[model samples]
Target: MRRKLAAGNWKMNGLVDDLSEIKALTEAHPDPDVDMLICAPATLIAQMAWARGTHALQIGGQTCHAERSGAHTGDISAPMLRDAGASHVLVGHSERRTDHGETDADVAGQAAAAHAAGLVAVICIGETLDQRESGHALTVITDQLRGSLPPGATAANTVIAYEPVWAIGTGKVPTTEQIGEVHGTLRATLRDLMKQAEGVRLLYGGSVKGSNAGEIFAVADVDGALVGGASLKAADFSPIVSALENA
Candidate 1:
């Protein structure tokens, strides 16, 4: 069975003082039933890992370069993230796609690099409001799943997060039925495309918070969530972690 995961993306946020949040989170959920992870900015990764030492909480990086080492000035490579005590990394997030013009091939390459560095790649794929309105959400997501995932991707080295672009940080969310449809479709697509699809975890993102986490977790095929704003604090994120544990 796939283990549930509660992942938080601090996303260009968090400072050295914010390491206290990780401590508070670990104190609140010392022995959580589901996996817990916090992906912070590269600057905080090593410190978060050090702060969460001996705790069940995992630390990760927000993104990584496709190459191991190169001339990319500000880009952190997968191996560098792994060395910084990160066991996982986020790839293909909408922000990167929109802000940096990252393509599916680029995402796939990054995932491959993460795998090479023994880091689990949290690959994200989602459709925009226009695509959803035009009835192309499924097609867009399927194409992304096909193109963004590398050949060697497995349950061990990869996880998928579905985050609708319009809903991210917008307090908008897809209906429960819509979420179920998309997750079910993703599961089927994975089953058809990979040998170990059953063990691959599917996480729902976009406007996920403690208030609505339980309901979202109740949806079929939703293993957990990739939270944004709510995850910045232990008080806000602890309840969502508890909800997933109960689910």
Candidate 2:
């Protein structure tokens, strides 16, 4: 069975002082049944890692460069993230795709780099509201998945997060049936494309929170969530973790 994960993306947020939230999170779920992670900003990664201390709460980076090093002024490479105590890094987040024009091939290269550096890559793929309304959501999502995943990707080093672009940070969510449809298609696609597909975890994102987490967790093939705004606080996130644990 795939292990449930409650992963948070702090995005461009978090600071040294924000590490106290991690303390509270680890305290709340000292022996959590599910895996917990927080991907903070580049500036606070090392400090967040230090703050987590001996707790099982994992630390990660929001995004990483495809190349290992050199010339990219503001880009953090996967190896650099690993050096700073990050065991995982997000690739192909929607914000990066829109704000930086990150193509699927570019995301694939980034995921490959993360794997080479021995960090798990939380590869994200999703469609827009327009695509869903036009009856092309499945095709768009499948095509993105096919193009964004690297040849070296495996269940152990890769996790897939499906976050619809229109729903992220907008207090909107796809119905549970909508989530199930996408995740089911993703699982089927992975089975045809990889050797260890069944073991790979599929996480639903976009407007995920404590209030709706239990219902979301009950969806088939929804192994966990890639939470956004609600993940910023322990009180908000802990119940989601608990819901996953109970699920």
Candidate 3:
């Protein structure tokens, strides 16, 4: 069976003081079949490790450098992330793609780095508002799938997250049919692209909340979630996990 993962991207959010929230979330969330993870900012990775081990929740990094090490002054290499105790890392998030002008190749390189360091690469892909409005959402998304993943990407080494640009943080969500169409396309793309991979996890990440998580997860190909704001609070995120468990 495909393992369902619920990962939180604390994206530029969280401080040393915010560790308490992670503590609270871990304390409130009991063992569920779904995988629970937190991708905090780089500065807090080491500290998050302690919180994760204590709470028994998974720890991850928001991003990592393409290179394993060396003169990349501001870069945090994957090996370094691993040393910091991060078992997973997010790549190709829309914010990184847009704001940082990261190309699909950049994401692929990052994925390769993550794999080399024995970390799961939560590779992200999505279409812009214009692409969706222009009815090219599937095409855009599939194209991203093709380019964002590295050649040796096995299901074990990677995770796919579809976070539509318009929906993320906009309090909007794709229709069930729309979500199915995209996720189904992503699954087929993975099957073709990574012919030997086993059980690649496909997660939805656009405005996912407790109220709508069940319905969103009902889509045929969705295996998990890459939650944002909702993940910061246990009250909101706990039910979403319950929804997945009950499903």
Candidate 4:
């Protein structure tokens, strides 16, 4: 069975003081039934990992460089994240794709690097508002799913997150039916591409919060969520985790 994952993308947010949130989370949900993870900014991965020591809380990087080591300036590598105690890394987040102009191939390379470093790659794919309006959402996401994923990606080292561009941080979310369609399609695509598809977890992201988390988790094939803004606090995030646990 696929394990449910409630992952938080702190995204460029959080300071040394913010680490307290992790303490509150672990204390509240110690031994949570669902897997818990917080993907903080590069600066905080090591500290967050340290704070989560011997706890069920997992720490991860928001992104990583495709090359193991190079003169890529500010880029952080997968091995570096692993060395800092990160067990996973998010690849191809929408902001990265939009801000850095990362193509699907670039994301694939990053995921491959994460795999080589023995870290799970939470690969992200999504459609823009324009595409959704044009009835091209499925086509766009399917293309991304095909291109962003690397060869040899298995359930153990790979996860897929679908976050609609328009919904992220916009307080807008795709209806449960829409989420189901996309997740189901993603599942089928994974099944066709890899033998370990059944074990792979599919997470829905985009304006996910405790208020809507239960309904979202109930959708078919939605193993969990890749939460943003709401993840920054324990009060807001813990209830979402509880929803997933009951789901």
Give the backbone clash total of model 1: 0
Q: Which ten residues in a row have the lowest lDDT in candidate 1?
A: 53-62
Runs in model 1 lying further than 4 Å from the true structure: none
Residue 55 alpha-carbon offset, candidate 4, angstroms: 0.5
How many clashing residue pairs, candidate 3?
0
lDDT (10s digit) by residue, model 3, range 16-79: 9888877777777756677888898999999988875555688899888899889988889999
Error of 3 at 101 (Å): 0.6
Clashes of each: 0, 0, 0, 0
- Over the stretch 100-166, how does candidate 1's per-residue lDDT look in tens digits? 9999999999999999999999999999999999999999999999999999999999999999999
lDDT of residue 171 for candidate 3: 98
How far out, in Å, is residue 226 in model 1?
A: 0.3
Superposed by TM-score, candidate 3 places the C-alpha of residue 154 at a distance from the truth, in angstroms, of: 0.9
Instruction: Please list the C-alpha lDDT of all candidates, in the order they appear.
Output: 0.95, 0.94, 0.88, 0.95
Could you report the Cα RMSD, in angstroms, for every candidate shown?
0.6, 0.6, 1.2, 0.6
The residue pairs that clash in candidate 1, if any, are none
| Tens-digit lDDT string for candidate 4 (1-247) | 8889999999989999999999999999989999999999989988998898789888899999999998999999999999998999999999999999999999999999999999999999999999999999999999999999999899999999999999999999999999999999999988888999999999999999999999999999999999999999999999999999999
